[model samples]
Target: MEQNPNKPKILCVKISSNQRFFILGKEDGFSVYSCTPKFSLLFCRKFQKTGISIIDILESSNIFALVGNSKDPNFTTNKVFLWDDLNQKSIMEIAFPTPISALKITTRFLFVLTKKKCFIVEIEKRSILKSFSINSPSDIKPSNSFDFSLVKRDSLHIAIPHKLRAKIFYTNITKPLVELTIKLNTPSYQLIKFNCKLTFLAVVSPSGKQLLLYDLLTGELYQKFRIANKVSKVYSMSFTQDDKIIALLFNNSIVRFCSIQLNETTNRLVKIENQMKNVYKKNLINIEDDTQGICEFNEWNDLLVIYLNGACYRFTFDEIEKKITDTVSFNYLNSKEVLESKFNFNIEKEDERKHKEGEETKTGITSDKLNENKNKKTNENIENELTDLVELLEEQKLEDNMEKEKGIF
Candidate 1:
């Protein structure tokens, strides 16, 4: 289902985890639509009046957050508005001095990212809990990429990569815990992304030649993939909800999926399966002016490629192969109100909390060091020791969880 076919290009596309609805951001405004069964238009809300920069929705709730667009004359870009779609009312609004670089929300907290700092706010109270900077005063610059991970529900980790080094901050504390200095002499231009639930960090190089994955719990380099040198453009890579599979988009149209597993003897991350599928076979001949968009995987392990043409294709994966199961187009239609009964859907809260406890055993940190290392060192010498200490603590935690499970069974 293509929405407005004659409008300007679609800038961004994202799907909720429930797989029932998707959102598209375009030149004029944003639209929400029903995605399951068959593509059906829900409604397109124009921002010409207030101007929205971005929209974020919780897959399991009716909560949505809108950030003001700088280009709009009616609103300031530094403000964020929280809305409840089910109730059809705005909850609250907050403003910041600096422009928001990225925005994310969980049930308990709202995460706002700036070029050098991150702000954590309590959702219900509409008050700031904590805010911190990712860089020091001397080295700070406009950051192009920032990644956030909420580890074990209570701990938030933010990764900011710079020219020669990348800093990883455990936002639960005051200072950065680790600085991963790139050993290579090459000048850096790469983006970093984190699998928030799994605590796996992926870094992609600008030349699209090298990809690295790190396990935050063990502080170990999990795996490395040498992307084909011939492929000049690699957009992004992400881990599936299960953290066992990874998907990578190349040259804007072709997507590759790889399965990750632990080697039995070595207990190291390994790629056990690999497959590649081309999404735009129809546009293969027209490569120059090919429209580009974004690729994302929902909770069900389905890969969705939403293109600039307002076309969305979903690829479902099976043990044997992957297939394109559905295609939806969003064609421009006049603004209209959708009846509540026609599109009413329920998202069970249990579905969102199912894996919270078990996954913590795999990524949890020992609670013993929370006080010991809370305020000890601010020097550079502690960087190397931090990795070793973190790994030791994680190993201790696994042993403890195993003994407790043994007692239960």
Candidate 2:
């Protein structure tokens, strides 16, 4: 198919879990287009309307959530409508008290982030499981940040920035677990990107001088990338499923890629034993006309980037690496010289060093053990959530039957 020279401006774009499809949100309603190996559109399902601003899709399950502008047909920003492409119908919908700023979805739940609060709902039953106030004042629009735990599918966390401090809360708990206080006395950092696997959290400093990546599970300052050149802002970014690669978007249509080494010795799957290699200064070359938007790596590890102009670019990991081959470098911090061991003794040596210096190591070890225990407990909570979800689905079925008796569809 020939490219439309006058195609409607692309508002947003998302790739499927399988990486075989691309979802485009334009000034009109959104469309699903098959992504051919050559990056051409194989099929198009355009739902014409005034606009579709927010779109979240779990393409593997054939489910999507769309938020439309008020000008669109039967659309309102205050509500989210769930659609099943297989049925070609709206299965369920939820109305919020305020207009939604952003949203995310998985097989487990749908997260809606409004200006002042966040709402989480079970997908199968469309039942509200929990909601909380974000405490972001009316005038100061909140920077968007939310993701499900990468280590556990059912766990979720959201970071809300208010002034110099940021509050990060998990869905299963009411209290904030991670509160980031910047020493710069600035209002807040603009960019907060959380890896879904819960491996790391990336944020652009308020001064825009550095990019900070933190170890989420350990709360350690994993690495820092100094920003040499000044840019307007970081629009969006995403970590690959393995948390080994990250892509960032900056002003003037530039996207930079970085590689990460988690410093795992024995097994890559074990989270507790892994440490991060220090990431140092790296020069980034500019990409094509990406005025504004986001980018992410699909499950297949292919890079999918969408711009405000509605153009979507897909590149294999090798292709991206080749393009920025010489633009990346990193450093590893070793405070104490210790021999590398096959038994993953870097952590043990650090504990030993702390003990010899008369500095208590129990607090650090206790914290790591606590996180491991929390992971196990959350796993059990997920199973319980699923059981409750089944009951809620049954209730929905009964309600639908009564509505059918009343001749309502």
Candidate 3:
């Protein structure tokens, strides 16, 4: 029961931050697709059996960072290639001592993470801008666990977990200008992400079963929510460009999308699970292996998920119906028309929409404060108070659902 070696299989997907392009790393090589104005297969590069394990595109450009992986890898695991699609060649290459585990490319720099060290490269100059190392590093391969935020107010922020602690670095240059450190509780964290604003941090607790949110400024835990009560490996987690919503994909048929609300008045980050939506397709995962899917968000809060099994899906939220609808789906392996998808979105109006939503959330939080004054509760009493709150919220949701059903009947 062996699959054909010549058959196409999407190994991973890397989406551009601008929502204009995405790279699909296949068993042969990689292909590029236009994402914003139109969804169409732009071009592809084949490397025989050499497959890309990880890739990061530089803001919808022809240039991208790649790390190869395959039974017969064309490049070594410790090497990274900066390939220029227009030229169809590797414009630059960097060799690391340890196997390159993960990488990300931004407008200014390319961040590469190894098991023992982390290196930052300036894309324009094509030079290693700076390198950082921990006294001791973990041997685990980080997937969507390590991430850095875009430059905001002059500092580029990086988050990497070392010795079970998340070490955050803030700098604008090769030399250290500033640094911030945060430590978590007894449980280990597998995923570490900073919101685009750098105001909040999200991590996976208990091996991706639960999500914990912390304030990056104070390293104070704000909220904790169980993403999956049962055993489900989280495949990926991504925040929208506007930082309004987050998408999480488990190693199953479930892709969960939830709204994120920040109550600045209370300094609380609230994950509205009631607003959560799931896109379920039994074939989303390979089911035979640990091949993980990728999930990302467009500026308009639309979602795109590419599974390793070659299924690509696009989802849109309908505010009028309070629903998430799977607008389009196609398999990249079988369809050359993946680029012909007509789901065009306008990102220019996203800023205004975010402002309006922020105002509405502030209003809602103000009214919620009037209903419950548990802000001053002690940590020792928080467990019971949270239980009561969850029970009350569940009852309210059940009643609302029943009323809706009655109206439909």
Candidate 4:
């Protein structure tokens, strides 16, 4: 399954659970497909470093989606087969450790984050070259839930929410490295969660029913405003590509958009000049449906809104008018639509790829179950030897002490 060079660009939003892979298309169709990972590894290895194909292994079923311009000759999997569409294939043989938390692909590396750790795999070799630990005891508890973004200019940022704090990590290093730790001023013991795009960070405080905005580059607080109490939870928040406005979704079926301005001044009081104007407010058609997640604003200026029931809406922004409107709904589950879409399928594929048995997984441990078994056995042997040695030393000391007492008597 390869991408068609001639098709229009579409955003593919995939959510995986134990049961099925929920796929939301940018065009007008949504479908649930079974995702398995067996053939996905085959496709990835065959196409490794060639940049000829992209493969996405869904978690729910044995099915996978393959997209790109060329197909790999060594790709194989009985459980993994192409979907009905000629352009994309669905694989059903492999599965991920946990549902994907975040995925990013660069020219040099593919990064995937699960609930516990971050995996960095080589795109060219189809092998995990490095693994990074993300969990640490801090004000924020390490959450299995998180999101990541690559800042084009100088850095990469990861946002993870623990019990009450959202920790942000900057992943860029240079001659003079830049790092900053900024904590959100929130109510005591209340969680202040956030979603990050390239330029802006959107923070949602549901306990207080407020949305806070921050400037990523300058570390300046942009806007702090309150939402309605009926808005039970602020599930998702995102900013436009230009950083001119922010969109927020609440549990109460209300979607709100506000205009934003950059107030740069020396005086703190005078810095808060421009007021946010409410652009649009709409009751979601499916009031009872759960929101899938907040969609990242793509380069095309389209904001994706995913509902928990497998429905997704693309909202386009009018910069001149400061208005946001729904552009289209993605409902099609065909392979051709997925192949033709221009959204970076490369990163998405990297996120879904998994290591096989005998191979090294991202945790830096061999995927071979036998390897772990052997390590455990070896550890037991060493422990037994150490225990015996300690006992012998203690007995010898006691014997020496007793002989000295006898000699003195």
TM-score, each model?
A: 0.64, 0.63, 0.70, 0.49
Candidate of highest lDDT: 3
Displacement of the residue 255 alpha carbon in candidate 1, Å: 1.0
Give me the overall lDDT of model 2: 0.51
- Residue lDDT tens for model 4, 192-298: 33333344455555363666665555656667666554435566666665555567766666777766655344211112433334666756674464443444454
- All-Cα superposition RMSD per candidate: 14.0, 20.2, 18.1, 21.2
Give residue 189's error in model 3 in angstroms.
1.6
What tens-digit string does per-residue lDDT give for candidate 1 at 1-409? 2445565435555565345566665555556765554456665555444544566765434456777554543246677766544323344567888777567765456778776677888764568987765552232212225665555445656655432344443333323454343332224435566663645566655565666666655545556666555534555556666665666666645565655555556444554222232222222222333355456675556666555454555666563444445444443243353532222112223223121211211101113342233333233122233333344444544554466431111
Q: Pick the candidate with the highest TM-score.
A: 3
The alpha-carbon deviation from the true structure for residue 177 of candidate 4, after best TM-score superposition, in angstroms, is: 2.1
The whole-model C-alpha lDDT of candidate 1 against the native structure comes to: 0.51
lDDT of each: 0.51, 0.51, 0.59, 0.41
**RMSD, model 2, all Cα superposed?**
20.2
Instruction: State the TM-score for model 4.
Output: 0.49
Q: Give stretches of model 3 more than 4 Å off.
A: 1-4, 48-50, 70-74, 134-141, 152-154, 164-177, 264-291, 319-322, 337-409
* Model 1, position 214: C-alpha lDDT score: 61
Clashes of 1: 11
- Model 3, 1-409: lDDT tens digits are 1234776566677777656567887666777775544455766667754677788775534456888775443476887877644323454577788888788876556788877678887655657877876422242346554677656313567766654344433333432555556666534565667776667788766466676667766676666665776766776777776665667777666766555667756534654433223332224433444556677777666777766666667787653454676567766566563322111111122223211212211111111432343333333232243234334443543554466421111
